[model samples]
Structure formats: C-alpha cells, structure tokens
Target: MSLAETGISDAPLILGSHTLRSRLIVGTGKYDTLELMQQSLEASGSECVTVAVRRERLYDPTGRNLLDYIDFHRYTLLPNTAGCYNAKDAVRTAKLGREILLGLENPGADWVKLEVLADTKTLLPDPVETVLACEQLVELGFQVLCYTTDDPVIAKRLKQVGATAVMPAGSPIGSGQGILNPNNIRICLEYLKGEDPDYPVIVDAGVGTASDVAFAMELGVDGVLLNTAIAHARDPVRMAHAMRHATEAGRLAFQSGRIPRRLYASASSPEDGVIGRTRQDRTSQ
Candidate 1:
C-alpha cells in the first residue's frame, strides 16, 4: 500500500511511556535569552524538550528559573545529565533531576536522558561507564534514554541493560558537523531495530542544520535530539521552523520508500511515443 493510504505519515512516535506527535526533541541551552528560547521552542513544534539538571538559583532573590517560562503541560521535560564525567556523577545528577521534576509535578518525572562523558575535550560518552549507569538507573526505576556513541555493540549493551531508548551521537555534542558517519549510524539503527522493531533510536548530537536532521530521519531513526543546530543558529526561531518541516518531510519520504540506486540513466519520456520516428526508420538509423 502507498504511504498516504497506510497513514504512516500521521503516526505518532512512541518512546517508552510517552506517545509524542512531533519527532523533534530540542534542548534548552545556549540561547541568548529565556524568552528567545521559549519562542524557538514554540516555533519548533516539538512535543518533548531536554533540560539539564543544575543548581537552583536560590542566591538571587528575584531570579526566575527556566521552568517559570516553560509550560510543563504542553511539553514533556526530559532532564539530562550534561556535565557528568563519570557513572557516579551521572547517577547523582539523574536522581536530582527526578527530585526537581517531581517537585514541579511534571508527568514524566521518572524519565532521564543519561550522558556520562569520558572527558571534556571530545565530550564522547564512555561506553563502560554508560552501561554501568544505565544498569543502576534501571534498577532505581528511572526510564533511561541513554546518550551513547555510534557503536552497535554498545547500543545493544545499553538495550540489554534496560534502557528505554538508545541515543547514538551523529557526531560530538555541539560540533555541528552533521552526521559524520552515516554508515555507522545506519548500522546501529538496523541492529537495534532488528532486535525490536518498535525500539527507539534517537540521533542525539551533531546536527548542524535542517538537512542534517532530515538525513538522520531518512535512516529510520525514531527521533532527533539536538541543541546547537537550533540554539546556536543566527536565527534560532527560523531554524526551529525549518527543522519541524524537515523532519516531517524526511519521515514521509522514508515511509514512501525511495527508488533503488542504479548506475545507468532512465528516461522519463517514452521512446515508443515519438511521432517523427517510425519503427523501420529508428531501426535503420
């Protein structure tokens, strides 16, 4: 059946306990101002957003928090462990995020985006520490959406440790290099989805622009999570709008099934319908 008839175009993305209509998951960081961030979020059409777990600004008596501007009812708040360099730190930050979300009465308070980096230079996740954190978090009853490298074995290990979603990096965080290794990303998706067709594989980083997001979606990833691509753009709000459309267009194209690659050219106009050329004349020529 055609994609239009199959209704895949209108399908909602199911991630763990949440069903989101929009596949784009943006971050709340690096924006010039909170108001601009809110405006960009509204323009992106994202149903879920990621926020880092950090200290409360209790020092400033009149200071407002990020949650003050965001409406929790409309968007799912996915708290992430951004600056943690080890499993212990990541676990502690995740627990703190849960506590903060619970205090705010957010619906998906138990869900945390886990990122345990190896160092500050590359910002690449440590596979060993990530697996350990995932196992501990799962045991602690947190729905873990793990940020990992593009290694298929590590992806499986994360899934095996009871992670809800395996988020493989398209490149380093905030690099804006786009998908540096599409082959590795594709292999990860294929291996993970082959195990469970409904499993969520979100491309978590290195999306420089709309085409980068589209390329990830075309590889059949369930979602795309990015920050710098939109937050660092010259016009963040406009880039958000572009991302919304790009994701939808890419998803539809994937569902439609593209034509197979070929070395030779195929003509659009029929050779049989030429008015000036008869069968004998064409053969003789």
Candidate 2:
C-alpha cells in the first residue's frame, strides 16, 4: 500500500526546528553507486539522510568529502559520529561536521546522530564515553540524538544529560536482529516517556524488514533510523519503498491504539444469536 493509504496524515511531520518532509531517515552508505543512492532516497521518501565524516578517500582535489553525492538542500543531512571511540573524537568529528557541512551560520546544527563505539568489532556504544560526549554536545548547543543500548539506566542517563532523543539499537549494527531485547527497549521507552512525555525514543539499527519497523512503532517508539537493511537488500529501491510504507503504517497503528488480549474466546456475533441459546431449545427429542 502507498504511504498515504497508511493513514499517515501530513500533519505530524518529524522536524528539527525546521520541518523535514519525510519521517523516514536513511543512510548514505552501502549503495553501489551515487545514482543508486539517489534512487533509494527517492524511493524511500526519506527527508533526512545520514553521512559519516572521517578520514577517507576523496574523489576530488578537496581531500575526503561527501558533498559530491549529497545535496544538502534536498535532504536534511544528518552527519554521524559513527567511528568515534571516545568523547574527544566524537566531539571533534561533530564540530568538523558542523563546519564542513552545516557552515558557520548554522552552528546550531539542531540535530546530531551521536555514536561512540567502544569496540570496532561489535560497534556497540561505550556507555561511559557516550554519556560524556552527550553532555558535552548538549552543552555545545547541538540537539543530540544518541545511539545507545536498550538499557533503561543508560537511556535515562542520556535523557538526564539533555539528549533530545535516545536511539537504542534493536540489535548490533548491520546484524538485522530486529528488536532482540523488546522488553528492555519497552522499559527504556516507558522510563524516558514516563519521566518526560516529550522525550523522543527512536529505534536505530538492526531492523531487517517491515515487521521489524512495525514492531518498534507498536512499542511506542517515536521513529527509526536505519541504513544497512535497505542498502543491502537485493532490491534496494523496493526495500526502501517498503520501509517507507511500513514506518507510516506502524506510526498510524500506534496512534490508533490496539485492543487488549483476553484469555478466553470472545465472539463477534450478536449476543442473542443461536450460539447463545440454552439447551432447552434442543430438548424436543
């Protein structure tokens, strides 16, 4: 089904001071070519896309850059501190991202996808470093959207440190495990929202398919941020489109509310139907 058919009214747009059209946030890594990346972005209807800044090969004389493929005007460029190991590196990378991508005038980047991985193999956020970086970033005037574990304490700490959003991983990055710890994630959501109803809880990473996206939303997650799932799909464009609709459907479902489950069977038939009749009617024999 189309995104419009999924009951996604245009009213509830996920914005960062300045409005972003699409709620689905995508990543710029893993696409075969620039054209493919553009196609996936168009197909996914993602208004916000991520770009990692670090020492890498450049296609031009201007050293390493992402400017060639990315059009900042078209998509909200969410530069991420993907490879940073400590608070110092994450903070430094964020500052550079602001300077190179956001420019000096827009120093208040308004949003940053904060990631401080402790281990290169697992790509898990180091709680100690992440919290330190979050505190520093928020103090620096950037709206921090931290990528963290599905631990209530960690999430709460991040929230206490002024993180605008806490993005807990469904599983390891690129693993496609899809909410490995739903109970923990739910607890995190409850803790943050209960503490401050306005805090945004986003599920980031390890979402494999549409169901995974729906599950996150069903659990009351505000939004989701993903990359490898779509980019590595056999048909990236199709997967992107699917993810777009899925996110909308999930959001709609959350707003619509769900029915509580019961132990015994409940009939939808009329209360005074034949099934409800007593044994007296069959005693003619």
Per-model C-alpha lDDT, please?
0.92, 0.84
lDDT of 2 at 151: 90
What TM-score does prediction 1 earn? 0.93
lDDT value for candidate 2? 0.84
Residue 273, model 1: Cα distance from true site in angstroms: 2.6
Top candidate (TM-score): 1
- The collision pairs in model 2 are none
Q: Give the winner by lDDT.
A: 1
lDDT of 2 at 150: 91
Model 1 weakest 10-residue run by lDDT: 1-10
Off by over 4 Å in 1: 1-9, 275-285
Clashes of each: 0, 0
lDDT of 2 by residue, 1-285 (tens): 655687756445543464555657889898887778888988898888888887765566774345666667677778799999999999999988877665724323567899999898899889999999999999998888899999999999999998888999999999999999999998998899896665678899989997898889888888888999899999999999889888877887888899888998777985455675576765652
lDDT of 1 by residue, 69-92 (tens): 899988889999999988999999
